[model samples]
Target: MTRPSDHDHAPAPAALSADGGRADPAAPPGAPPGHPRRWAGLAVLSASLLLIVMDITILNVALPALSADLRPDSVQLLWIVDVYSLVVSGLLVTVAALGDRFGRRLMLVAGFAVFGVASAAVLLADGPGDVIAVRALLGVGGAMIMPSTLSMIRHLFTDPRERATALGVWAATAAVGSAIGPIVGGALLEHFSWQSAFLVNVPVMVVAIAAGLWLLPESRAARPGRWDAVGTVLSIAGMVALVYAIKHFGKEGFDDPGALVAALVAAVALPAFVVWCLRIPHPILEIRLFRRRAFSAGAVAALCTSLAVAAVLLLLAQWMQLVEGYGPLEAGVRLLPAAVGAVIASPAAPALAARIGARAVLSGGLVVSAAGYLVIAFGPRPLSYATVAVALLLVGAGMGSLAIASAVIMVGAPPEKSGSAAAVDETSYELGAALGVAVLGSVAAAAYRGDLPASWLAERGVTGATAAEARESIGNAMEIAAHAGTAGAELAARAQAAFTTSLEGASLAGGVLLLVAGVLVWVLAPRDLDVSGSSHH
Candidate 1:
């Protein structure tokens, strides 16, 4: 009759302390059974790694164009852009644990196959419904890809230093993937159709699938736990509700009925799920992991970084093309400095951490990021592309360093829980991005309203109900008002001004968050980088 919590259990070393420190447990006292195929395996794994990361943000540059072509209503467009992340966030923990239960390489190869077919589905989609369905399926594939890669790395490299170096490379590829999404999408959209963006994934996925089959080594859970169906449902439902709630708050504030309902549902469900986790004999995600200080710190940092930078690519794409009138490709080309900076800085992070301490490097990077945000926030009324690019490079540098924080979490976690740990990290990253778009974008919308002239609505031929509706969709409204003669011209100017002010406010808020995160990291992250067996390779 006794509950699970009543069961006597010996805690892990980290679990016994207040700070909940980690212990190295990946490699046994004896050396790992060395695989002669390690080199080819690592290469194949890394290459396959790039595609999953790339898919996460590659569609951003094409969103505006896609919106026009599809003529989706406001909600539909947001889903078209956000469903991928939302689904990915909700399923990461479940999928990661599944990979651990099944086999990492097997899951990875299966993931590639699923991702390829999903990408093809996206390419062939003729309507919004089709695209959305395909995108959701892509998320399923992505959930499989993410944890498998990290867990495979854990099994592949036994030496902590080599593992750290390999993770740095892995982290760099992730950063590069985010950067490449826009550039590749921009180029493909400019020269070909929007479908080409999805199409490009096909070839990359094919390569990964083939390479994985040939070169990747197989590994799975050393001691697997039973899948917790109840926990899985609660986690996914709670996440979906929470994201919807957050999005609702951004769009309609605290008072909106939809927001209220969603928030309440999430509040109840998430806590209930946590209780369920503590009670379950085998939870899908080990809730006890958060008790680790390093894991907790890393999770917070990851979320903060993504929240602060989520709007960067999207807003920048708008700043470059919509406000400045640069073509998609031209805008992406101009943004290359930041991409270059991120790529260069990403690889150098572990080395930097070794010298200055992970705490110092991460904290310093956050502070630098705050500075970048301020530069963008207070820049000239009609922003200069060059100035924005410079600020973006600083932002990129900040992000580059932030990427290493994952290594901290992974290395700090017990190797037995590597897949779950990585899954948690990836989930935080995805959640941050989704929340950033929803919250920051809302802030921008509010600022736009305040900046607009009273006459602006009348000028655009949007009066009464139409004007109220138009206010809800500044982008679409502005586009419609742009070609309406003198009145349209005035409306366009007002819309532009509104959007600019909104952006400025969002940037300022982001700046403050970045600074706070810096302080937190400096104060909370452990001084020593003694992550060994605790982290997966």
Candidate 2:
């Protein structure tokens, strides 16, 4: 669905080797091969990635205040949070295709402008509807910005070794942004207002826009063929339905009929989209990449790890804020260990892979992640911060494995196909985040209800509807506790205890999943897989 353009500001194509295959796009005519400015371009792309990741986590701490200020009902509140992700996840493939057809830098620059405007528009938002609309706008911008980051990296660092290193740094920055989201949000909320979270993006996006203009070069797919309009529509429909299905399952659990119907829709639409992609000459996603065992193994590894950690990180924030009675800032600061682990491990992933091989490194990382989950699950009562910190360290450190996974994904494809490859990688990540929150979060929520002591509530003289309310969520129990007398205090205590038990059970379940994925990666990822060699005929 791209409109052909006469604008020809795009950078000249890099020269190919005599083999007539894809060559290093880093080199332009009359300029030495692999220009040093490419590194600076990498910096710009990484900055964009950091900003988006931070924005996602930053909202978590601001949601309550936003709700209070806007006075949104439950459905509106959900939309305020859910709409952005739905929009981003649904349109990623389409936008990435646009980037390929038109220009990567063009799409990226437009995204920055759009993101900056949407974020600043929040300053004028006086109601839930306004905020939701702005959030949806930001999602379109985010969808455009995200895929360009990886694909640009793929183009900028044509040397396999340099690309691997760049990817590692990019991965670390991404993890850091996610870990620091609460801290940034808490810091802003403490000094400013809820709108500050959205406003903060304005300045960052401004800087990104300026830097991108100077540093980034325009690139596009050399043979981006006819736009698959029907495929694009199907992808959007399927992904949106899929995200909704996951959200519904997370909120209402498996018994909800709405979730069931949404799942049915997703089941039909997604597979149809996949079949369409396979039959087409030009697809938004290169599903054929999964035919490579190394690529498939790495993809599965990334998805599994993301599924486990996404939920744990989410619940950990709440555990710190509500259960442990820490302020948002303190909770965010305490979570720094996870960032530290990522910083250490991500940069080391390439070296580890070089030494031990992709299969071993990927599998080892998964095993370490599973251990971290187990540690958190089995931690002592009162949820010791020290124990959780260690688990966070392990979790973050283990994500270094994704560096290798990412390399496999990118290297498996030729330079011309990087956009589709990047889209596929991002899609796996988005799906992982969705599934993690949906399935693992649902397990924790179910366990929370199961562990809620109905008998204990009765003994405290809080039964029936009140008891059910207490079991609904920690926030509800806290609201009840604030208004109720001594019985309310007892109810809140029981509810917190139940949530803790539930979290532990969920962590145990995630740990088992990682362990199984680790085994699969070990078996399926070829031991001799090398990123540098994948592009050669």
Candidate 3:
């Protein structure tokens, strides 16, 4: 079987400009002059990306306040957090395919409208169920927005090098959004209600909807074949079931029959979905792209980086607030080292890759991140903020390589398959986050429990339900400590110590995972891979 060169996958003749105009005929072959408003349009897309990424972390900061107001049980609280990702991950391939069939611009605009409406609807949410519904709607909106940004970038920047730069900016925006989410949420919670966090998205989204329509061009697959309805269903069912199974396993381990059933569904449906895609002419996703070493390497880099960072970041946020006794805003500020490192490194990654090689940058970044995690696991002393800050900086700097990963994935694919490529890239991120939290979070939780055994709690006069609660989480233990007098102080100290120990254990595990992924990617990625050119060979 002869493989097609990247040149064979160039933008279709029908692709449009940023102003929804015809492509420039006078432009050079394989490197057309992009839309006049391309740079400005990138700003609009970056803003949208910022909000989408920020929403996840903002909820983390707002959870305590929301919990106080809604008084949701553990199950409901879990639903409120997990449902958004569930909906987003399940719908990504379907929505991205729709964008390619319809118009990327239309999908983006609609996503903005949906996001704004959902954010505003938070005002009416008076219960946990209402908030959960609102989150699901936001997930729908997020699903629409994420891939469109990447696909649109592929359209707007015809030059592979220029597109790489744009992707670097896009990656930076995502890093900033995640880094600042807690700060924004903390500020909102300080001045207003937990509802304010959701409400804040309304105005920005309204503006984004207006700007996106004006700035973004309408582009779609010039010859998108008939929709693969079966493929869509299988993809959705497989992803939803897979994510659900992971979440359930994390929460309940292998003892839960429901998790096992969900895992079974995912196992069957996913492989079947892959076969269905291969058999179809116009599959919902471009499954064949994985044949390219660069594309596969990029996907692996994104997944492993997200997996190594996500759960640790979430745990650190709690560590700052609960163990170190920092306020939300202060903790958010302290967390800035990671963001700062990313901001500095993201834009520089492409340039760095040019001097070295894409393979080195991508694999080296993961190696750096693994070092950061190892630092956290083996750093000096009783775990101070200074030690954590250094570790965060290293980790964030390492994440900058994702820009290279994105470029490799997008540039490696034909423009006609941009939507599919983007969907795959985003899916890696979403799945990685889900897996990180589930797998690494379980590790941390088990370690925490192991350190604070029920027997120890019982010996400390925290018998029955209180003892169980203490072992449940550091947060619950601290809450009990707030009112338990002398015993309370002892419990708080022990719980904090246990949490710190668990964080170390989880970090060590995550570090090992990252090291292994780095080695794999290093072996897989081509030594001479050039992200600026559309050639794998």
Candidate 4:
């Protein structure tokens, strides 16, 4: 982390209202000054964000290839899949604060360097252990990049409308990246090798780093303080414990003793950190930001929407590949309707919000999302790809609206807190995505297990096997059962049926959650319908 420059000194709380909300417009404190290369700077920032967000889903299509190549145990496979997000979520707040205290531009360049190096490491990784280590490094690099981009944008675009337009572009990148990752990964997996996925980031980051160095201006917290080392440790520990407990519950059930202990640790650590913050002259995480109604509502909405969307995307990919037997390329192509719709909706969100109001946009989006889930839950049995496509289109549209609502949260806040605000929003987004995958993945797995046959062992002609053996060889059991004649065929069909039934139930639950979210958004978001030019990319 870069050291705080001499610019920081004693200042009053940044013009926040008693409720911790910004009562004044988010204008720059001085006359609007132009940067020689602001547009190039914004582009570099956008590229950085696109690379990090896109990576979130890039590995989805590579899971089978990865498993075959790495030959990891189940536990290793889980970590290989989740450790990037786990580490990223744990470190976001601490890293974001570090950037604010030091310099956003310096952090951006350093982060890009780290990401490029880490990507190279992952591509060259010889085994699962190496890949996991590289992924953790990528997470650290991502932690630095995310907040810097938002803070730079906060500093770059001083006008509210201009800022909203910039943020709209930023939000569009996220939707586009999410939409494109699997397709890109699939193409790479088919024509080249899995290593190509990591290699691709090299060029993107290189361009971004060069442009950032030439164009981005230095910006930092107006009244920086000493790096809060103790606060950083407490925050990471609390987040890791909390997320680990949640992840453990999804995997081993809520009753697992280890998960219970993790949950307890999280409970104690999080509050203790907050109390510690109150005592510190300069805290790493400004927990007081939550007092802002718009900020608070926006953060919660971002988390909820992300959680719902991540779960849906994961399950949908499984439905297409495992259940429907679609090839990687074919499945990725089928996802285009949703991706295209989201991209189209994303750019139009600012104008739409201007017409209907932010609260209405959010509430309406949630309603559309809930309806999409209902369509999935009640769609014809044996599944129709067309039905799935249409449902995703609706879900994508809804997500576009929520993205705009979130843009408002930052646009309306004081500029000094922009990094912190963006940090909070981004944190919710990543954490929500992680929880979504974990909770939904676990539910889906349990459903798959429940749907499996008691006759599986008998069909294989095995009375018993060691726990590790059974877990590792579940796929072999299915293959064996399929070849064992009429009994095996019946067992296989029953298992498939059970899994599909579980998917239907999960979709229905998702619909209910989206509906509840819609109601909350309607009740909680601000009534003002106008767009301010205060937010940035």
Best candidate (score: TM-score)? 3
TM-score against native, each model:
0.87, 0.85, 0.88, 0.84
Checking candidate 1 for backbone clashes, the offending pairs are 24-533, 24-534, 25-533, 25-534, 26-533, 153-537, 154-537, 411-535
Give the per-residue lDDT of model 1 (tens digit) for 1-537.
Answer: 000010011122122112212223543467554356765676777776666655655676776576556655544555666677777777877777777788888888888998899989875677777888888898888777776776776677664434444555566566666667677778888888777878898888888888888877788877877878888788778777776776566656689898788788888888989999877766776778887777777777788888777765666666566667777777767777666767767656656766776777777878887888888888775767767877888888887776566656666577666556666777888777767766676676666666764466775576775565446545555666666567776666666666666777888989999898888876667777533222222
**TM-score result, candidate 1:** 0.87
- Global lDDT scores for all candidate models: 0.68, 0.73, 0.78, 0.66
Runs of candidate 2 with Cα error greater than 4 angstroms are 1-40, 63-86, 121-135, 154-168, 249-255, 414-416, 453-470, 534-537
Q: Is candidate 1 or candidate 4 better by TM-score?
A: 1
Q: For candidate 3, what is the TM-score?
A: 0.88
| Best candidate, lDDT | 3
The model with the greater lDDT, 3 or 4, is 3
Clashing pairs in 3: none
Across 273-374, the per-residue lDDT of candidate 2 in tens digits comes to 889989987776777777777767867887888778777776777677777888768877887887778767766676667677767888999999899899
> lDDT (0-100) at residue 163 of candidate 3?
52
Q: Taking the tens digit of each residue's C-alpha lDDT, what string does model 4 give over 1-537?
A: 000010111011111112211222544467375455666677777777777866766666666556556665544554665677667777887777778778889998989999999988875798989988888898889888877777777687655434444554566667677778888877877887767778888888888888888889998878766778887788788777876676667656779998899899889888999998878766776677676555566666677777777767766764666557676666666777767766766656656776777778767877887788788889877767778888888888777666555555564455666555656667777777666656665565556555564455455453444222223323333344446566666554555565566667667777788888788767766677333423221
